[model samples]
Target: MIKPKHNYTGKPTAYLDHNILNYFLRHPETSAFEKIFEEQQVVYSDETLREIKRSKGKENDFLNKLKKLNAMHFKIFVDENHQSTNDAIISDADPFEQYARLCEQLHIIDKIYTATNNTLRKFHGDKSLPSIEELDQQQSSDFIMILEELMQKKSNTDTLTSEQLTKLNNYISRTLQHQKTIQELSTKMMLNYQRDDNASMINTYRAKVGIGPLELNNVKGPKIIEKIWSLHKDLDGYKGRNFSIEDFLGINYIPSNLNGCIPTSSKIISAYNVLNVIGYFNDSDLKLNRRFTSATSDANHVALASFADTLYSSDIGMIKKGRAIYEFLDVRTKIITINVIDNRPL
Candidate 1:
């Protein structure tokens, strides 16, 4: 697996989602986050800057706070030299390559199984594996077969060398940890917004448009959920046209920052395919209204955070979706909300 270069101090690196940054800026009295920022290695992506620019009044103020925090900034684009534009920040070309490469290097087999099993349980209860038709329809037949075969091989531990088995065990352990984290986050989200559908949807919709929370009643929840699902279903036929790993790596794009941490095109592409199987875009309960913005800034933020140790966001939708993607992709980054930090003891 590709391991990220780490600082010698071993402090965890964090990525602050735009909404969280906004919260910090608006509520300076929330010194809890300020303390956390001081203690952790916080980072921001070009996407965050773009989001800040949307509110001209806050752009400079946020940037100044970041400077004060000594936060690191990185470009998520495949080409480091790419101009900082909203369009560039939300483009899939670089993120596809970056994630595909990370997947290739991490040898993320166990996580793939965990993600597949979770997805299967969610969509097709009691099915241990996806049917051939389902896999074929998702364009993941070959990928699933490879994972099944690998899992079979894993069961025969006697055949593996000591080193290989150790590595396999590590991957399995990490995957289990990711699954646990997902469950915990899901539970927390459920508890926090159980009776507030409007709060949940508004937080989710914030990624698309900066809107305040609307007072949606329980009566509207089912309809909104159905509408979101319908949107997903309607887009199924367009999967082939969506950006792929080959599309990114074929261009030989690599981010300019972080000392040229790059992965092979094939591995990066494989990671991208694995995410597709896990249904990052389609299956998650988090509603992503792709129609609102041409640039999927929310997804891009999550993708960039895959490189960090933690991702902080107030948007319930991004937190849910980000956690799903990170867990499925075997990205170790923790997806959290501002509340988690606020509740932490100083």
Candidate 2:
């Protein structure tokens, strides 16, 4: 086994999904993201490029634009044909995920930082805002009160001369109109209307605030410590049960911003989806957690999953991507940055 190195600071090799690459190329006006994209060297494979080619319309345009913007930045790798491998591993290819899987097989993913919108509950009212239906229930009572107040204010007004009343009514109308406009604006901001279904607007806001994706905030590193410890104890293969929590935090604690490993094979791809939902990253705040394959029933062997036909499972599909960063609080009560990763898929 490879021993963990203490002073292991070095440039990270990241696998950019095609979609994420497009976001950068398409959003040139987004100067901040452009800077982030410029920081990492992009890796791809010929198969991935072909996938890009096979893609049509906007997808094609996006890839074409990226190829033009920084042609020199992309590195294409061709691993091997797993023709003789078990039928379990055989699957249709998605170049982006494939390249990422390849990276994992090669042990090149030091950390995978995926940027995503905040999927956590927002602090609002007495409790964090609930789902829209629950929010409607809570606000319904307040809505009645507001309407009643409006009626009372309207009824108490003095009857005036025709011209004066006309002016007054106009003023009231304008005020109500303005309030309507303000309400609309407020609703849009609060409920996040006019935002992409993928919550890209939330992402833009988080980026503006210098906060990373909310998903990363949920990566349970400590819980992972617990699980890893349990695995060490319960699993017969793990010999070193003496690792401390600090060591686990420092070593196994993968920041959301750090891309840990790539998913070069279909089995690894399946593992990514499985791990993502299994909540292996429960303690991580940066949503830095990713699904990975582990030893199976047989200690000597591991099993991989299929990708093409089964990639769309609702569970793994739920893993949203955006900009996630890693942070730790210092003695001064200040947040220190460790890493940053954009979750826009390649």
Candidate 3:
């Protein structure tokens, strides 16, 4: 394999996304060069660093790992000021913008190799920097790409077969299974909330995932507010039966899209219509409490057994909502349709 002469004087920096660096640090095979890369100028934002430092003390170990790299190899700078302004500049309004801003700041200092996919465009948005897409099309992906490229540097070297590459990718994916599972489950919860037009849960989920919600003006008709108020009035703990449209907006509640995409929401609305066919939700908190209470693993099983009797007493609306969801997914497919109600709040 052809190796570049160590004499090259170009400013080549290493940019690490907080999460990706964490992944590498935890992986024994990839982290073999932890000492070598420590001396390199490592790029990361102050916000990310602070978050890592405050939330995960393990980051101190990663920092120490960086300290072992040769003197001229790594530089760490905290990015506090630029991130906030950069967030203000972006219209799309996802929290990822903060990382994009960090990339922009890093590019000003040197030619850095960044580990983030989303911020590549932001870094290359200026005429001076080559767009990531342009660079990839002309050359190859960076960092990992550089490693793979180096493996094929020899004139007669055999390239990895498709099957070999696939196996490697699968291995990497499986190795990262725990993180992926949490992410997927979080996505499922967000998708469920979005379908239900549960504005509160939507904001909660977005915040949980480190993304910001785009400002949207769509509102559910007054009928929804009236129904919710009337139901709340009947519920014992409901503080007030009267709320302004502003109250809903204050909660960042957006109209639930009742389209075909969210079958869970469809099941919920369908169940509610059926419940009105029966004599449910005539009282106040009775409907709200019965549906929205938390359940233990034991309670969930018991709830399933006596669901018929429990249906009219517990949070009917919430149970129906959750049931609609449970049905659409059909994890426990034997559930009676009557026991189901969309549990998520709009």
Q: Work out the TM-score per prediction.
A: 0.40, 0.27, 0.20
Question: Model 2 residue 302 lDDT?
Answer: 12
Tens digits of per-residue lDDT, candidate 3, 131-225, equal 43454433323334443433344223467556555544543343234223423333343344342332343234334433221211121333443
Summarize candidate 2's per-residue lDDT along 25-119 as a digit string, tens digits.
55665555445446443333333443354355555465455454342222212112111122221222444454445544332121111001112
What does each candidate score in C-alpha RMSD? 18.3, 24.6, 23.8
Clashes of each: 6, 51, 26
- Residue 10 shift from truth in candidate 2, angstroms: 13
User: What does candidate 1's lDDT look like per residue over 1-346, in tens digits?
Assistant: 2223452353577888776677767777667777876668777765666566556666567777777666766543332221121111222133323333444534454345344333223222223333323532332433445555665677686766667666555544444443444444333433332233233322332333222222111213223323322333323322344534323222222322234434332223333323322233323332322212212456567766776678887766556545543543456778877664544422
Judge candidate 2 at residue 90 and give its lDDT. 22
C-alpha lDDT values of all predictions: 0.46, 0.32, 0.31
lDDT agreement of model 1 with the native: 0.46
TM-score of 1: 0.40
Q: What is the lDDT of residue 110 in candidate 2?
A: 19
